[model samples]
Target: MAGRIPHPTLKGPSVVKEIVIGMALGLVAGGFWKMYNWNEQRNVRAFYDMLEKGETSVFAEEKDRGPD
Candidate 1:
């Protein structure tokens, strides 16, 4: 347990490269995730309208089909 220890671990730009790559991927994924949520929010009003219009197609699929 003895070596040149001044932030010594792969003593190169390895850590910086890793951090940059990780940040880039994380940013891309985060942006896409935000876009998806924004889209969902944008379409929420239409979904609610469907619900308000007595539309059961979406949520009533697994419900008990009652007597004729």
Candidate 2:
């Protein structure tokens, strides 16, 4: 065993690659989250507009009621 030389591990490049991949994934996830929130806000604003125009209701009518 003493005659065999130890092999060096390539850790630096592997760690850098991992960090880059993590940042890319984080950015993609953050973008999706922002898009989701924006869509929700837009929908809420549309609903409020409809309500102000008397085109929608906050409570269901008796004829539109479902099973209890």
Candidate 3:
């Protein structure tokens, strides 16, 4: 075994590749978060618009109330 040559060691993924993957994942997550917030805001705005138009009520009727 003294005359035998040594084999080269294998390397893991490069730092640049890892960084790019992380950035892509972050972007996807951020996009989803933004979309969710936008949808929530839109729903809230629609509810408020309906309220302004007197299309809905937030309180129960007098007959539906239980105590004084």
Point to the candidate with the largest lDDT.
Answer: 2
- Candidate 3 or 1, higher TM-score: 3
Scored by TM-score, the top model is 2
Supply the global lDDT for candidate 3.
0.92
lDDT for 65 (candidate 3): 66
Residue clash pairs of candidate 2: none
Clashing residue pairs found in predicted model 1: none
Q: What's the distance in Å from true for residue 40, model 3?
A: 0.4
Q: RMSD for all candidates, in order, please.
A: 6.9, 4.7, 4.3
Candidate 1 residue-wise lDDT at 41: 90
Model 2, 1-68: lDDT tens per residue? 46978899865658878999999999999999999999999999999999999999999777956778
lDDT of 3 by residue, 1-68 (tens): 47989988869889999999999999999999999999999999999999899998788656756767
Question: What is the model-wide C-alpha lDDT for candidate 2?
Answer: 0.93
Better structure of 1 and 2 per TM-score: 2
Query: Clashing residue pairs, candidate 3?
Result: none
The list of candidate 1 runs beyond 4 A from truth reads 1-13, 49-68
For residues 1-68, what per-residue lDDT tens digits would candidate 1 score against the true structure?
Answer: 77866874565668888999999999999999999999999799778888789774475357777997
Q: Candidate 3, which segments miss by more than 4 Å at Cα? A: 1-10, 60-68
Assess the local accuracy of residue 19 in candidate 3 as a C-alpha lDDT between 0 and 100: 100
lDDT, residue 42, model 1: 78
Query: What TM-score do all the candidates reach, one by one?
Result: 0.52, 0.74, 0.71
